[model samples]
Target: MIRVVVVDDQAVVRAGFRTILESEPDIQVVGEAADGADAVSVARRCRPDVVLMDVRMPRVDGITATARLAGPAVVDPLTVLVVTTFDLDQYVFAALRSGASGFMLKDVEPEELVTAVRVVAAGEGLVAPGAMRRLIVEFARVGWPRATGPLPDLTARERETWLLVTRGLSNVEIAAELMVSPSTVKTHVGNLLAKLGCRDRVQAVVLAYERGVVRPGLP
Candidate 1:
């Protein structure tokens, strides 16, 4: 079963998510919290596989909570799926930088929510392609300056695979593009993740943008 903890300030929202998630046989709501501070404590106790977090909760806020639970400093990080009513780029960027594995609007369909949780739990990132593009554009617009120096040592093939990943290409698509087998693509992706110190493709995508390795609307 995929254990999950739901955190939101609104009681109704928490109840709704619990109901939707509990309906899935493969998923279980292990705990719930009404604010960010409580979320941290509940998650620590439950050690859930996934956390459905709200961005604007009082006390600590989802971004900080995510950083605490899943940041690079964490030895054993929990997968966080940030669900918020707002589609603002700031929230999305903050959540990603804080080590969230996925971000979704609160209005997302119940089915999509379930899939997102499963995806993140399986060690993948689940941001929509459109949202990712917007995130890159927003970063560019703001001139989000990140330290640009020698990139982590990556082979030429691994660098190509990383660029395709940032472009939102699936493994099969990357394989097709590079004329290689899917297993080969997967190997390259794994190597990229390890070398970049990214938790998943989502983090790698964000890192690519932050490092100016990839830009919005570019080939």
Candidate 2:
């Protein structure tokens, strides 16, 4: 079973998520927290496979809580799916930067929420709803402030791979786009991650935008 912890300031929201997740045989809600402080405590104690976290909370915000539990700074991190009401561009970028495994809106359908938990539990990351537009807007606005040549370090193939990733293409899609195999794309992605010092594709996407290596609103 995929152990999960539900963290939100609203009692109803927590209860609602718990109900939706507990209905699934593959998922179990191990604990619940009304604030970030308790969320951290529950995470450490339950060691859940997926944490449904809220962005705004008392004591500590979701960004800080996510950083503490799943941030790149953590030696071993938990998978945090930031469930927020806001689709604010800043929140989307900040959550990814803080190392959240996924982001979703609070109003996401129950089915999507379940899939998101499984995706993160399987060690894959998913960007939140409307993430692409937000990503592009944020990057386009911020990336050129310190513009330079196509990331000087990336190889031709690596740059291609990075472009596909930043465009929100899946590994399979990238393989098809470049007429390569999925494993080949995966290798390129891995190398790009190492070369770029990125923890995951989310960061790669962010960097690709922030560096103008990829443009916003481009497919």
Candidate 3:
């Protein structure tokens, strides 16, 4: 089963997510937390496959919680799915940068939520929700001020794969785009992720923007 820990300040929200996720035979809600502080402790104890984290919890925000749970320094990190009520919440980007596997708006349909947990659990962060797509368009237009370039030593093909990943394309889509097999795209993605120091696809997407490998008004 795909064990999940639901973390939110609102009791109803936690209950609602638990209900929705547990409805799936492949998913089980193992625990719940009312805030980020409790979330860390509960997650540590439960060691869930997926953490459904709220963005604006008291005591500690989702960004910090995600960093603690899944940052580069973490050993055996857990996958985190940061959820926000607002689509354009800037903190959601921060959570992504902090190593969340992915994110989605809280108001998403129950079916989408279930699929998100399954996708992240399967180690593919991007699903049909398109949260990463919104992040890319928004960041591409606004442009981060910390203009810095210098991607790690990436081969020509690896760089191309990295760019497609930044666009939030899945391995299958990337394979079709590059006219290669899905396995080849997976290899490129794995190699590029190792070079870029990203734990998952979404972090790689964030790194693309932060490194200035991709930017506003530029492809």
Residue 86 deviation, candidate 1, in Å? 3.6
In terms of lDDT, the best-performing candidate is 1
Using TM-score, give the best candidate's number. Answer: 1
What C-alpha lDDT do the candidate models reach, one value each? Answer: 0.88, 0.82, 0.83
| Candidate 1 vs candidate 2, TM-score winner | 1
Ranking by lDDT: 1, 3, 2
| Residue 180 miss distance in model 1 (angstroms) | 3.4
Give the count of colliding residue pairs in each prediction.
0, 0, 0
Worst 10-residue lDDT window, candidate 3:
127-136
How far residue 98's Cα lies from its native spot in candidate 2, in Å, is: 1.5
User: Residue-wise lDDT of candidate 3 within 150-214, one digit each (tens)?
Assistant: 66788999989988887778788999999999999999998988887777788777777777778
Q: What's the distance in Å from true for residue 36, model 3?
A: 0.7
Instruction: Write the residue-wise lDDT of candidate 1 on 1-219 in tens digits.
Output: 999999999999999999999999999999999988999899999999999999998889999999999998999888999998765778878888889998888887899899989989999887766566767777667766475766789999999999988877778989999999999999999999999988799899888877888775566
What is the C-alpha local distance difference test score of candidate 2?
A: 0.82
TM-score list, all predictions: 0.91, 0.84, 0.89
lDDT of 2 at 21: 94
